[model samples]
Target: MNKKIAASLASIVALSTLAAACGTPADTGTKTGGDATQAPAQKVKLTVWHNYSGDDLRAKAVRGQIDKFKAAHPEVELDAQAIPPDGYRQRLKTVAAANEMPDVFFTNSGSMIKEFYDGGLIQSIMPLLNKQTEWKNNFTPGAFDPLSFNNEVYAVPVNASVTSLFFYNKTLFEQNGVKVPKTWDELLAAVKTFKDKGITPISLGNKAAWLAQSSILSSLANRVTGTDWFLKAVKQDGAKFTDPEFVQALGLMKGLADAGAFQQGFNSLDNTQMEQYFISGKAAMMIDGAWALTNMAATGTKEQLDQIDVTVLPSVPGGKGDPNTISGGAGGGFAVSKKPTGKQLDAALELIYTISGPDGMKAVAEANQIVNYKMDVDQSKVTSLFYKAYNLTKSVTFTPVYDAYLSSQGAEAINNGLQELLMGGKPEDIAKKLQDAQAKSIGK
Candidate 1:
């Protein structure tokens, strides 16, 4: 969380408490059940805020699950709203300002989760999960670690994601006589091969800026400075962004750009356009988040889809990082409100469990999206691309992306500075810019 955002939320929450209550009042009086000691099963009406507003496969799958959940629990009314994807944090902040936080909502696992937990805005679902042991065991090992703070889990793993990946068109590669690259030199050679054949070597949509940071630099940084150094720098423990290892990481990105490795005017292209280029076979390869598999499935042709595959960014020879490592983690999930009472809390917990559990994961798998849960999914029903991505993730040592590890301001600065670096800016200068932003961010 950014310090400014935290402070603003604190003030708003404080003020909102004076004029408004956190949640609706519900009757918890005794009702009919096997156990008379239990409170009445009051009806719960929950507002779920999420970012699946678009008509994509993930959204469709989520809506399908929500319908199933509704069918299973007819008494519960879930008013789910699809929030706009852009600047969602600002909208959340505004809602928090009014003390109208949703009963349950989608939240990422990093700084936002920590700040929400620290501010008493969200509650730990560990106790609920512990009680539901079967459901608890359905998550992949270490999946909950990102959502856990001080050994206590606060959120349920919903969407397990690996952000840094080389999504390539296998058809293009084979047609052009290019093989999947395993090392820096091989990757460069492939880039040259594609470039010489008048095909765009790689499609990068850096206009959004974070795409560069999340898709390329995040993994490259890991390959250069290693995860330990990056984590230490995130904590401001004497590891500076301007360090040689970090500078070298920036240099690698610039080198690729200079080599015409990416589509021309890539810095001006948004992620959507870049995806267009790749899906249409105008670009041979693209580096993107694992979540892109869903987009690819929805937008690509059967032939194109069959030819799609993924790999981790190739190793940089003599780099501190392992070639088997990649940038990834538990990206986002669901967290219940700390203030919901009576059946609202129960229903919210159930919603999280059902949506993030094995059944929900199966649905996600059916949609060709990777769910974070540990479950056996029928791979035959999904595309081969999904299996390739799954194997790629399982093989790599995961590292959190810079945005996930840094404060909002620091993360934004990194995205912007890296964009400048991609546009012919010096690595040292961008490194200093990132260092300065990180200084102020950590200080705050």
Candidate 2:
């Protein structure tokens, strides 16, 4: 079955089970236990939807937090439902259209937040944020940029993600006697060294399409022309992708692809297959997000994990850009629906506060050490390489990728264009198409 269909069906089953047990209408208020002489205060049930099905560990961690919230707030019953990550957005859309949205839900901070905000289905969190001093101080500058629309915050960021680096196999590099590259020229030379040593320099699984565009070009563009220019290009304000910087970046990507930097049949391999290639030493490097390290650690041996190292892509020679500029965003966050009542809202806010506060923030960061939250965690718990990547990101200027900054429609177009480009579409054609689509989207 399609992943989206399966998730939607699972959501239906969950909703049905809840309905059967409660025997209450969707909007019916819960009756609290109080004095019979006095009218009982109306109790509200808040539904929360999340997609955290990657592994039992993540699921258990999240459930533990939810259980803690439930034990503290008895009046506001929380109907927490976990959906498959692949089809979560589709299921959320279906729920919204049916007017059965949960009081609070999990969503990405970029175009997804904008869609919910424009539809008036979600509430603006700016007021709540402004009223809370501790919450405001918990985040770093640009941390809320993804959840902001027209200068109003609509969501609270719980975690941060960046596509600034890819993990490489140090053993492979050392065996091949190739030093890690710090410039585009050195990168090309290292690729040749790996090739001469009969090793695949890059393990890129383009079967998923977005992985290539999101994890590679997004960061490369930042390294090529700085974040401001890239953002301007995406926004169609005064920049174009056909300009020297973007064209050069695209050309470099093409050069690498043509030079056999990636493994054979890369376009046919899925993400898991590509990871296996790297883990088993068939490939030397893999372009992926920071989460890649955690996933590998969860399933690989300590020695295997120790062999991996993360670093930002090298700068282009003679390019007017800095190596310290990074491509990233606020990642996933929490948002509440506008239809929830005061008590339910209070409970949801409390839950959000707990999960995104200092303690929870530190836990999440320790789990995925690449996270950019301003929470402090014990350094002993994280790998040295993870700390290296985290500190590198901190010292850089980060910018959200196109999908995290563009409108929903525009983001889809960019994804499609990227796929086309990877499949041999001309760079000029892709640039022209993206620029035209962006202009049309912003006009509407």
Candidate 3:
């Protein structure tokens, strides 16, 4: 696995030797002069884990930040493991169970963060956060809300994202005389218009099975039932996933597929293929995470970048939910494990601050990715397209992505059921399946 165990062992040995040579058996102090000579800072070794192994720009930016942090803190021994994103959650949970988690690790600000917090696997970041008011204020307002539990924050959110944005080709929309839809009916009309022109209205690649559920259905559910119903259903406070409103959200997914909104054989294609389809102009629009803005900038030509515009999904007609609400929260960031003392704790905290602080966020933004830190970038240095998409978060109300608030098992069931729904499963059936999963998650 090349998990960097050797580096850690070497660090432990070095630290042990240093500890053994300290003052006296009982002194425990490193000071050695009559004038209270200060000893050198104790050696600190920290293991950091993150889901950023690929050559994608996001991963590259993280790697760059780690390099900078290391260069700036030569006294701290930082062992970082960039695990593949696919297996990240499983690995995190496994290590967490063993109580041998890395000193610092990247995690989303959602259910898993709460799970870790409740299990005492993660620690509150307030100690360092309180001392750095300027750093804390650098985050966008409410960005840390999801990472909080029982009035204490557990992680520093690095990236902000909205999961329900529909990015469309402006040229295609203009050519087809189709305006960006502002409401449910207008959206369907635009879909019909594109269909009439023999153009695919949407490109969806759901082979991963999560794009439809987490990216699409999550937004639709928020549009139909709002955050209140979702919370009620998730908490089992008399509301249920099987409630008619929730089922109706499922039905909406079926209706879109039935209406031929997606490209043919979409279920067979993966997210990368869908991005290709959209960039190639084979599809008029794509529904995806706002984080895709970076990918688009990195891979798309200038013409394509100029033609792309992002907007929230249209509102559901006659639904209780607010149309302006979008499914998303603060994106993944670093969390400190409950373990670590003295210098180890200091190193972990420093790493978090260095990665998510203004300096780190500025470097991240320069890489064309959005950051949660509140700073206005120098416009001339970045593409205007990037700024356009980054500003989209301000207009919409944010809600948690479906899987973000659900347990792993609950999320898996929802994703599976949605894929089935795309293949002609009934909404009621899918709703019941999800309800069953939710019940199991809560031990009911």
lDDT of each: 0.81, 0.73, 0.82
Writing each residue's lDDT as its tens digit, candidate 2 over 1-444 gives 999989987896687557757875554334445643232343467888888656533344555677778888867767888887657888998998898888888888777777788888988766577777786776887778778778877777666767657678899888878898888888889888888888898887767556777788887866777777877876777887668778777777877876779887777776667777887788888877666655565566767777888777787777666776666767777788998667667777777776666666766667654554666656687666667677777777765576677665666666677667766677777776666777788882
RMSD values for the candidates in order, in angstroms, are 7.7, 7.0, 6.1
lDDT of 3 by residue, 107-210 (tens): 98788788888788988889889988988987887888888888788888878756777788899999989999988778888888998899999989998787
lDDT of 2 at 240: 74
Error of 1 at 114 (Å): 1.6
Which residues of candidate 1, in runs, are more than 4 Å off? 1-43
Q: TM-scores of the models, in the given order?
A: 0.86, 0.83, 0.88
Which ranges of candidate 2 are over 4 A from the true structure?
A: 1-43, 56-60, 97-99, 126-132, 268-273
Task: Please state the error at residue 412 of candidate 2 in Å.
Answer: 2.1
| Model 3: per-residue Cα lDDT at residue 49 | 96
lDDT for model 3, on a 0 to 1 scale?
0.82
Tens-digit lDDT track of model 1 for 264-379: 78879887788878988998889998767877777877788787788788999889888787787876888887777777888888888778777787887778777767766688
lDDT of 2 at 262: 87
Winning model by lDDT = 3
